[model samples]
Target chain A: MSTLSLTTSIVDATGRMLAKYTPREKINWGRLGVISVPSVWLFVFFFVPFLVVFKISFAESEIAIPPYSDLMNWDAEDTFLSIKLSLANYIFLFEDALYLDAYWSSVKIAGVATIITLIVAFPMAYLIARSEPNKRNLLLMLVVVPFWTSFLLRIYAWMGFLNKNGLINQGLMAIGIIDEPLIMMQTDFAVYIGIVYAYLPLMILPLYTALEKMDMTLIEAASDLGATPTQSFIKITLPLAVPGIIAGCMLVFIPAVGEFVIPSLLGGSDTLMIGRVLWDEFFQNRDWPMAAAVATVMLVMLLLPIMLVSDGQDKKEEA
Target chain B: MKKTSKFLTSSSILGFLFLYAPIVSLIVYSFNSSKLVTIWGGWSIKWYGKLFENEQIIEAAMLSFKIAFITSCLAVILGTMAGFVLARMGRFKGKMILSGWISAPLVMPEVITGLSLLLLFVALENTFGWPAGRGTNTIIIAHTTFCLAYVAVIVQSRLSMLDETLEEAAMDLGAKPSSLFFLVTMPLIAPALVSGWLLSFTLSLDDLVIASFVSGPGSSTLPMVIYSKVRMGVTPEINALATLMILIVALGVVAAMVIMKRQHRLNKELKE
Candidate 1:
């Protein structure tokens, strides 16, 4: 039968492919197979999606099912392929003050939050790293334990603490500190608190790693030379920990710029963040192309910091 | 030095208090008898009971767990293979591209990732008529895509730090390549694998934004449900649920620390 002949040919092809490699070389093929699994998976799901976003960003918005017009269409009557593309979305993003303000505020807020987190986390990391060797791991574990809990719940907890009748207000009143509750919830202050609280662990770990690995002998030598402790810290410790500082800052800043949940939950309606803008454009207005444009721009903005962090990591690995 | 030590100790205490205060308050309010989360009434277990009775929340939690479990398992397998390849295979073609592909998702924002993946699913559905519609399957794929990056990084670092001579010695003893891997490399990397799995599981379970994009009508995860509710305002039931989550996570962390400490002591004793 024809089916039998086809099956034989299929088997013949595979046998020929296998025969191309010697027994020892076949292991190399297996290695290829192993490496190919994740590479192919990432290519299909991660890389390809980004390409899809790029493609869709050039298309026009439509009321159709997918909510975006196809870039290429087949004309049935004329029997010809037609391509349609527009730069209006990108132009609109540039022209609109709302989008501009969102980007500006996102960077400003994330930057401030990152700086505050570093100021708080630096001393904490130094203390942990400088602790007795036997006790250091316990301190490190305490820092990491908070990170294991739910992020959303942590933010929600902040909401409770910041609300009008919340604990912070009640505590202040009970202690006769203030007669009125400070306007904290649904404000920019709350967003900063949520971000700083959530990202503190991230900022601490790298700093701890850097500080722990520092040479105590250098500090001791500096002190022996009659340099003050503060002077030695500034002269030696600060310079050595720059890599960690940069790494922690980028780790906090990059994601914080594109953050949605914190701003949405904790920020006031007047708060303008690009992540919220993109969400609204896509989900509310059903403007896929415009949303894609926003995201693409956001990615471009974040690209430099991301590369800096990754490059720093590579250097650290090399060292 | 004494003055500096005092400063360090006090600062460390304040830092920890800052970190834990909100969580402690959240837990305390979960026991409040009143529906309002801020107003303190007499203590009661009513919210815990109410949380159990809510069928929607129960269903959502189960779905989130199911997705996380499946995502972590797949991520571990794929990630381990990728990690092994990166650690062992040196100076290969496209190495830079491969490494870049592995690390890119780590820094990519969740919103952009979600948007792009959503578009991919839609386009694929339209073209191939497969994956039919977005739901749990789509969410799993999206989650695994990101989670695998974390697992790969962890496993890769662990593998690089390991001594490769053990594998070579195994081979010299006439062990086959596959067996050498299973009996030697796997056992050595078992700790890394466990940690990687736990990290992936937590990341998938904690996700809200990416899940929101890829999930469909009937497949809402627990975070999605909680997010919708939290948007309106906090409720006693949510506080109760959060407390339970915190307790479970705290227990897991404590157990892990205890085990790690025991292992450390055992290693020291063996060396001595």
Candidate 2:
């Protein structure tokens, strides 16, 4: 019995020592599997596609199945690889006033909508942030409730409200406020309303989180030091909220520029956002290469803003 | 301070009015018994009754729910793994690229993502002769790619906020790593997983642009159908549909709020 006990204790000691010493050399199959699965999936499905897009952008459009020329060509007669790189699509984009105007108007519309969202969101966020703690959760939840509902439905709601003979016009007529139905649908105004309505929560949530985290006592102290409330707000609150504003604006503006739904549904035929143009070029015109070129250019244009957003996030994290 | 508060109060009220007026009006008009959608004839449930008979909508909704269900489940699995690596795995090779891949989808425009993904599928089919065509499967894949990002972000945050000691203690008690994850870690982060799932479902359900790009002629998603309908014009049936959707969302919100309150109370009691 003693010999058996002694052998068992020795085996246990060796086992513990082996576990301790060999851990580094051991291959963790489980961890490796966890890491590799997502990485491979994302690499194939997310990252490589952008490279494909970039490659396709430089190829010529053809009347074939996929409708774009292969970038690399090999000839059997000669042992040589030739790349058929064409910038014709990009050149076409620059030469075409439609593309230029679409880019310009998309930027303008997105920027204006972002500014409006900010104006509406700030007060709403501030109100929630400064409210009694007991009620803040409910208030914030209310803000998020609209977000949880159908985004399309929210936009569709406005479509009905702003229709020529819809609720707004009917109500106005009943109130003796106007002679004829106001034409609000199929206009930039409608697009702006849709954008602001859809993106308000995006703007507000970040602003609320930022504003709530702020030092309320700093504003109080500034006021105690004989500064007026407006002065305290400008000096203290506004500067601090700049990061939130940037984050919020980026959240709204980045997607807004490439927005397809708002422009198609709300804006008139003359509304020329690049997103719609790309959609049309692909589906309507069947110009795959040209569409790829448009998408590539749009991405390049957005790179600066995207870089700024990431850099801001890094700095915010450091702080 | 008083003046600012007053101004803020008024602006906030206006903002809430701005946020909710259109939706409330749409819901109200859904009940109107009228040929004209906007003009109220009387109160009737005809639209709701008619909505039940719409085969196209029913088919489209079934398709959307099926897609969302598959997408959410796939996303949670892949996303949980991704999030696990991000939160628990120390510095490793390709960490930067992996993280960038995960977060980039959050801000990337739907148009660009859709275009690139569709192009990818075409190229893949050309080469591998798989994913034979764009349809519900393609839509599921596209939605999963974007939805996984959300799940990863949520799960990562939840994991980070969790106390590490609980997990360490479980390990000390001779729990295998796999068992520890399922038994302890998962239960603690179940709320985040649930939120991620719900978020994925809603996002996949509401998606129009990406689904449009990936979906073929026969596989029309609910959003695509609704987009076509809304583009033509508003209908009372759409109003009824919108109202029904709003009701579901409202119910979900209430349930979430109740659960959150209960969680808060439990935490407070534990502290005592």
Candidate 3:
């Protein structure tokens, strides 16, 4: 019968495989192989580098090949331990107004940019979400396709638009609105424009996802009870979209805080973002320990937002 | 109600215009004959010729493409494995730590990630004498590390949505674990894998900050080259390059959308 033939084939397969390992051993090995590759990779590349930054932050700067003193050294007679670990770099960060000012400005700029992006993106997301179902995909694609182009190029485009002889200025001049071209390039205004433009897509996608999934009955119910459209939006829709807002704001804020290219290319000497500071310390000043300290401080500052995002993900999964 | 709807439609149109105007201008200026990007002269394609003639740009672009291709492949393999374990593997020791490691890159600031990886490369070179120097290899590794997180998220979501009954039935029919995976699970997750690959590819290609940190002399990626040139000022040649990039990306996106729509229609018809 078929059963007998199947049993015979199973036994033959087991007879050939059981010589090397059991089924349980095979599964365990497979599982280990699956997990170890990424685990080892993350530990070596991601986690260990963080520890290195921490380690380097404590060492003294030196005009040497590695550019930092060893954390520990031995005396010539080998009788004493010479520890070179110092808080000079961190102390320098605290003592310097440049570093403090950079941090403050970075927070202010990124904060304002996040608000602007959210305000601009919210209406678009709501409109797209409320559109006819068949048209929603096409609208969403329009928002996202621009994101596929090079970010650097898009930021570069803003440079052309915001320059003194740029499009905005030229248009204003042609319309006789101004006698002189506006000094928009290399100003804080330019920085804000660049950040908001670059990060708008990131803001829109999350908002759209949340809004599109929202039940329409909530809004309908509110309207049925005589709440005006604006009142319903402020009271019902905005409150319900809190999760998306938080996600979108975090996405915009965190990266914007450490945004180097925008501030470097678009911002003038007045805009001293922490990322630009870190870059100058590392590349221009050749101060590795100082740069490491800056990076470490930034990581600490960002830990809260990162935790909130991950925690948000966990809550969603649980729900 | 009618007023609100009209307002919403106008706002949406304006929002999209804000998004597209700069790009449209960049493309338009690429055709301008003037050396200055803002000024309008006669139309010309001379910049496109210059863009192609630049050996440095060509080399950097080729390198970027090669790195992106390899990074996406590696990221997919490693990410699929990590995602599979997260979705299918029941609770095990250190699950929290594993998941944390997998997701950390998603929210970590690029500056920090770049600095840490650069430091790691320096340390590795000092200790092992391998990697020899920081360049394409380091950039690819850094890209894979982050892109892996994205791929894992996509694949994990896809896996969670898949029905388990098919795999169970396959096992009940005497399929080994490996055979069950290939015959049942892999085919089901093919779409996720494809999308994951594309996402990773684009991310690797678009990276600038991290590549700036990790790339060495003569190994500058396209973004690095473009950033350097763009910092000086917007030149017509750069505009030409940007125009070409936009055209390619636009074409790719359109092609993908069309294919996805066709596939959706096919599925609906089959169901009917």
Candidate 4:
């Protein structure tokens, strides 16, 4: 009995030592550690940054130096004084019809672009998804390969195609399709083309994922029951694909609302977006507080919808 | 049936043409012997020569590469750790919030993300007296913060598909947990890690908005240089640079795909 007790104690001592030398033994501990790193990083770089911007939104706007200079005034004790924490910036947004107009224009453009992209990408996604498996891979590769290039380069390439003396205009004039060079660049139509070209892949990816996961057997069974092709599609395929549609729409719409590069490159000065406005305020006008206010508004609008969709998605996944 | 298939084929062709036409024009015009970007002269390598001679563009390109390499490496590490926990460990309190925050930047507006980071830097400088000023380091921090989401999502998805039994078997063999991770789990997820790293690298290299916000004077990235230059006047030398970039990226993708296919086939044969 004494030998048995001695052996048990020996094992316990070694196990304790081993546990001490190793990482946290509790699963919760390790998980928490893992969660904490990204959480802290996000809190510092993302969440806190936004909070800082929100603080700046309440600050007084002063520009003496060049753009990208100090945004706030600090006291001897390191307390911020410029952030007067007033309602002036928010109030300014309400009174400024131009800002409100830009926001509405951005929303309308994003909506129109999402619908157009859906129309274009849906057919392409459908074709790719319904094709033979071997061929589908190559086709999807073709779709994604363009995204490898710098996004701005793609927009630059569009300028070559859309300018008055550019390829499209040149081709049309040379072929007698038009009497004169067409003003394709710096137009809202050009903006539409630029955005649709850029974001079409975003739309296609989720749609393809949705279509790939769909059970063809169900569709066949529906058809075997004497239902029409469209009926089978509507009943079996559409419902299952709704998640992808939502995901795709959100992906496209959110970015389109904040798109500045496309608008600046392809559209006229009248092309108004919140992103462009924010950029002008920060970089051109040197109004950091006003820029922060614009950014805060965008963040608020996006956060609510994202949370709603994500919660809905989580519930669906759980079900 | 033939008629319908023909229609579908034509539409696909048209879509492909629409996508490829601009790219082809850009490439062709890169070699044009003309100063004007729109009008093409005889084929020549003059633009390519000019592209190499431009010191500003070359410097920006090098900066972009250096930043991309470091950010991708760091992002892949943290993302892998987070993904391992999310996939292997069961849920606890704040799991939902944790996941949400992980993916929030993936969909967040670039302007907001950039603006917010700028604000953070300004605030931090005033308070901590560290990070001295924004430059390469700040740009890297901002890039890593956002690109980590892509890496995490990719790793999490891959881990979900991985067989958990392998890790269990390793543990049962009395292998230490740390050794088990390095020896078993890492080897299994190495492909996902590679792809995630590549994705993050490309994203960092391509980013203009966030980089613009965080980058300081003389730390101008390739896209920034190109943007400022193009805004002044579009040039053929940029076309040459763009074409070269497209070529390099295409090669990378094709190589990755070939390797992945071979790996898949080998795995299949072993299973059989």
Q: In model 1, which runs have C-alpha deviations exceeding 4 angstroms?
A: A1-27, A76-79, B1-4, B267-272
| lDDT by residue for model 4 (A135-187), tens | 88899988888866678988888988888888888888889999989888888
Clashing residue pairs for model 1: none
Q: Comparing candidate 1 with candidate 3, which one achieves the higher lDDT?
A: 1
lDDT of each: 0.88, 0.87, 0.86, 0.81
Give the per-residue lDDT of model 2 (tens digit) for A1-319.
3334335546665666576558567777897898999999898888888888888889888898888899988887898899889999999999999999999999999999999999999999998988887778888988999988888889999999999988789889989999899999999999999999999999999899889989889987998899998898899998998888998999899999999889898889998899999999998998888989999999999877775665554244224
Provide the DockQ value for model 3.
Answer: 0.43
Model 4 pairs whose backbones collide: none
Interface RMSD (one decimal) of model 3: 7.0
TM-scores for candidates 1 onward, in order: 0.94, 0.93, 0.92, 0.90
- Candidate 4 off by > 4 Å: A1-31, A64-83, A312-319, B1-7
DockQ, cand. 1: 0.49
For candidate 2, the TM-score of chain A alone versus the native chain A is: 0.88
Assess candidate 1 and give its lDDT.
Answer: 0.88
lDDT of 1 by residue, B1-272 (tens): 23457777788899999999999999999999988778889899999999999999999999999999999999999999877877876534444456667777887878999999999999999999968999999999999999998888888888888768989899899998789889999987887888788888988998999999999889999999999999988899999999999889878877877776776587579659
lDDT of 2 by residue, B128-174 (tens): 99789899999999999999988987898788877699999999999
Stronger candidate by DockQ (3 vs 4): 3
Of the candidates shown, which would achieve the greatest TM-score relative to the real structure?
A: 1
Chain B fold agreement for model 4, TM-score: 0.95
Residues A71-158 of candidate 3 have per-residue lDDT tens digits of 9887879688877779998999999999999999999999999999998998899988888766888888889888777888889999
Residue pairs whose backbone atoms clash in candidate 2: none
* Every model's DockQ: 0.49, 0.50, 0.43, 0.42
Cα lDDT, model 2, residue A213: 85
